[model samples]
Target: MKTMESIENEEAAPRAEHQTETPLESLASIASVLAVGLFVMTFVFQNFEIPSASMVKTLLIGDHVLVDRISLAPPAKWAPFTFYRDIHRGDVIVFLKPGEPDLFLVKRAIGIPGDHIHLRNGVVYLNGVAQKEPYAAMPTSDGDPQHEYNPYRDDFPSIPPDPMYQVTASWQYELPQHIENGDLVVPPGKIFAMGDNRPDSLDGRYWGFVPRENIVGRPMFVYWSFETPADQIEKQSISERLAFMGHILVHIVDQTRWKRTFHLIR
Candidate 1:
């Protein structure tokens, strides 16, 4: 029943204030908010993606985690010698990878200052006592790769001569015969950490202890997660434009794991 002039006038009417933002404007506002979030996240809380499965079960691939940044310093981008707090065992931490300053890694605290640690049959022992690790949700079954890469070595790819290799029964970091429990130092301001996936993890064992300053932040929680299609995760791809587009759409939609939406990262 509306006349053409009336309809045109109605269409020309000003929109609500909240609805005035254009798509680009909405994007800009979102970006501004994200920038503010990053500033706070970098200095206050940190956001990271679990790109690898080294900490699987505790942290999964594609899981987004947040970390508190008030505690660590020294090597972090913030300020030097500004130790706001202390790191503790059992706390999940993210750190600048030892030896490789360019890369960052996340793991759980296993050894502390002055704690003698050893790996027996690929199990961790603290102060000569077997420390039960409950966070390792999956049963350890993989064979140890003895030639694990030691990053600290200038040779780069050569394996280090660790005493752990000398054990006759199983894989373990055999403490020196004379190095008593007190000699097992994590140093004055260093921490020893390992991934929950012990066998697959490249951690303190391969690169030496991580300096306290190298720590990035403690992982907070899962903010976002992406699902890998059981078949597509490891699938190789083509370089063609149309083919690649088809591949990407299939990868995103078919792989969208509905059950994992908003799932918390442990």
Candidate 2:
């Protein structure tokens, strides 16, 4: 009985002494956690904040969204476990702006490669069929001046783009090359995207096609949303930014759209 008890004490002493991790071991554990977090944020997922009203009811300004970067990315042989798929029509995608590579824009894919597209009276016609876009905020007679129809905006590609409009010079030169039988034909390795707020959005019509490689990811859901001004993104000065940060800190609870928390993005 004594020998048995002695043996048990000897076994228990080592475990008790080792139970409390050394300082080095504790730091190593913390570093491992940080490494995993960094990897997930950089490659697996990313967060973005909407700064414009282009998407309107679909995605409002100041809405922070979680983006799934893996699914839309090109499939890698090393990461065979990750799923990948091609972008389809009507899928809202986040991508770098074609002309301005630094700027990021989110818009719904209207035309994929080889699609014949045109707009008549603000209605999108694809492959000779008019699309039923319930999400699009079309022009209405409700007296909102922003929604009023303009010939160049409503009847797209039919009217020659003028310099008075915000159409890019590069797009004006390339636009005619894609027009066929009064329809804009999407070429290979490119996509035509437009905003949900048709009248207000400065999108594909004004610029050009989005390259397949330029797309970043699809937004999975809105993680947080705050009521912010349309011009908040334009405030670049340090003082102006600090003022807004102070405003957010004070109004974080009340200004936050609690209902939109975790709201799934379509």
Candidate 3:
């Protein structure tokens, strides 16, 4: 028969064992959690910030958005549960800039593959039909005699583009090849993207078409919006971004766009 002291020791032994876990075991648990988080962030969703005024009233600078990466992900043979929806016209998308692959850009998808796109008097026409753009910001040119109308902004795809609206050299070379009956024909595997604030944007009309593979995802909502200038938001380095986040934390009340926070992106 065990003595009282022995029984007490037995109970204490289990308590001690339960409390003591090896450092390696603890590390493995942490690593597992981190791995899952990283996988979700890389393939399921990601955070993006608006760095320019090109999307203006629709998406303002300093707006932090959550993008659903899975919706546009390439189909995987091994992942049967994964689903994909076609990218339709009028969908706002975030994609890698054609000229600068590292830079991510957000714009409305104006033309899909094989679409005949054009613009006239600052209005977009897709497939020979005028698109209803209720979200476009105030027009920069209100027929002011002092403000010279930019041909490229008011009218697009003139055989010999106006020198005033000189496009990128690469786009200049490719623009003519896609012209069909005066409209810019989007080639297969490419999409034409433009900003809601057309007058201030340097989009497909300036750079070139957005390749299929370059598209990242569609923004689900504005998780947070801060009143910050375009120049400050353009800083992309890790240290710079961290510093900017810290600034937001300190000046949250004053800089936060409270009305826009948690706003759904259309």
Please name the candidate that would achieve the greatest TM-score relative to the true structure: 2
Residue-level lDDT of model 2, residues 41-67, one tens digit each, is 989899999999999889999999999
List the global CA lDDT of all models: 0.63, 0.93, 0.85
lDDT of 1 by residue, 1-266 (tens): 99999988777775454468789998999999999987886688877867777787777776666776776543454465555667777778888885568888989888777776655455566676766777663333344343243232212112333545332221133223213532344666778888887655666655567778788777666766666332333445554545645765778666554555555544
| lDDT per residue (tens digit) for residues 1-266 in model 3 | 99999999999999999999899999999999999999999988999978888997899988999999877766778887887876889889989999797899999998999899888877888888987899875345566542345676668876454345667788877788999898999999998999988878888888889998898899999999888866885577999989987998899999888999889988
RMSD of candidate 3 to the truth, in angstroms, is 3.1
Per-model TM values vs. the true structure: 0.61, 0.94, 0.87
- Distance (Å) between predicted and true CA of 249, model 2? 1.3
Give model 1's TM-score versus the native structure.
0.61
Off by over 4 Å in 1: 1-35, 71-84, 137-184, 229-254, 257-266
Error of 3 at 207 (Å): 1.2
Cα misplacement distance, residue 236 of candidate 2 (Å): 1.3
In candidate 2, residue 11 scores what lDDT?
A: 97
